[model samples]
Target: MRVQLFSDIASGAYAQKLLEIGEGLLGTDQDGMIPFTQQFCHAVESEDELIEKVFPNMQQNIVDENWLCERTILAPKNETITKIYKKILAEINTETSVYNSIDTVMSSDDTTNYPVEFLNSLELSGVPSHKLELKVGEPVLLMRNLDAPRLCNGTRLRVTELGRHIVKATILTGEAKGDNVIIPRIPIIPNNLPFNFKRLQFPLKVAFSMTINKSQGQTLKVAGIHLGTPCFSHGSNHSAKECRTPVRCSICKRTHHSLLHPKDANSSEENKTECVVNSSEAGKKQQQVLLATALVKTICRNGNEYSIRALLDQGSQASFVTESTVQYLGLKKTGFTSQIAGLGGN
Candidate 1:
């Protein structure tokens, strides 16, 4: 049941409502695995420098192995995984298996037939119609739940036989471990696309590594997380138990609640669970904070416009923009540039 709940959360069926509470402990109770993975990543970044000094035994775990360096990575959405798979394949200059999705043409009993170009132009389903690369020994993930125990959804697999019609994969996870399964073309309805339109394709995706959301119920002994942005899910960071050998965390400089040195007396319980947003009250507070904050906008007097993302710091007296933003916007400076003093008076 817990595993199913975790899978549901990963599917994002409970995203909006849960996301609201995800800023609180309720989200953690819903799905703790992804949050734990994220926290583990953050702790890795935070303990990078002090890892050797604070936890001598864990120092080697930092660079011992990296899974993200793999050629493929799994993600929650089929589209996302497809995109990542394509990108990695391109990066490695590897040849991918090209599979053209079947397009069914039908004329309604009372409706006129559409043109060939129009039918051809119609967008396909969630899965890509282009080349899909699958290599032997590379990790793969099942896109659908065909079997509960043997080849369930989100199951990790390794490619063994890539046939023209069927792709044979060995299960690398769960009770079906070491068992080989043949994957067949499955029907899939693309999200937000025409309801009547469907795509039939192999129910397999590359999974050399995966996004935190797609990593439900899977225990990761080692992880490599590249944070392009802040985690938006609940329990977005690693738990204290997961930080026994964290590798690269951004908060290493902060002496306050460093996870690397569990023996430290100053470490607060709250610090260890920074990603675990506990309590409805805390969730409400987070929403209120977001509501109160303003996104800064800039417009040239000449009617030139640009969109940008900026946080409104109510505590700060001065408004600021990054040099890159200014350059990108081509905003004219009213006067000579001056170095603004920060909190440290630099």
Candidate 2:
């Protein structure tokens, strides 16, 4: 069997426009159709515009400026993405404003405890420390699967009450809607690590904005994406049933790879070539083709493990299995389906 190993294809506005029409046909066949959701993202800009400008536009208008700000959750792909969030927070936390951290307390379950140094070396599965910033009415995303049906990972919530010890929140969207629940620090073990590390922290994180990689397997009614560079991954910018209108940077009119676009492309090209004699930069480099295979173990819901042939693709954000493999393993379905598109158009 010839299987494509973690390949990627690019798409522009034209390809996406056709996809919207195709999904529209499918929606028309279904009587109860949900309206298409609009999402925005920039391919080469930090999330500062998203946090400072785009988010505020979506907030509900309040008469009192002194009142608590609208609730929001912020999500980053990694620690590196959090720099922008921290920067925005620093500016807001002036002499006239205040911010605080809700620290998590770690306690051992049994009377016999491990040494402080040994325990200190352990790192949690999610957030490292228990420290969190809380703002009343802000939205939050559950980071771990606590209750699969009611409060699973990716569940949305709104903060109602906060403290140094615990948080009181109300479920915003799910079967547990309107349900008030107290969030506490919980112990977790990191996966695929040599050491049996364990730590306690709240199984939650911000969600107002998240990386495109993390957004996979999710359906968004409204989304704002901040693109810092061209997405080199498959399906990074594709979505179903929604028309995308490129919002060019007000400062730079061009879209592709731009922090700022030149006023005239033709003019800039001439000037760029002129500077080539003075700037002795090396020529462009070639990309190497990478291929690797492995025999990997897959565990099913019933706990049956199978060793199967798999591709070792570091670039892929998710793993995929064939329909036949799923049937052979008798894996149970979660009943959730996502439509994935590529250059060949499906």
The local distance difference test score of model 2 is 0.48
Ten residues in sequence with the least summed lDDT for candidate 2: 1-10
> How many clashes does each candidate structure show, in the order listed?
11, 9
What TM-scores do the predictions have? 0.42, 0.46
Candidate 2, superposed: residue stretches over 4 Å from native: 1-46, 57-76, 88-130, 217-219, 229-346
* Worst-scoring 10-residue span by lDDT in model 1: 284-293
Candidate 2 TM-score, true structure as reference:
0.46
Candidate 2 lDDT tens digits, 1-346: 1111111222233234333443454343366433443332333245565665535533442122222223332343455345544554444322221222233224444214555454554433344334555556555677765655667665667677776567788876666777898888776655555434455666666555444544433334334554454444656433433435474434434232122122323354443211112122356332222235566887866898888888754323246888888897887667678654321122
Off by over 4 Å in 1: 1-84, 90-95, 105-131, 190-194, 229-346
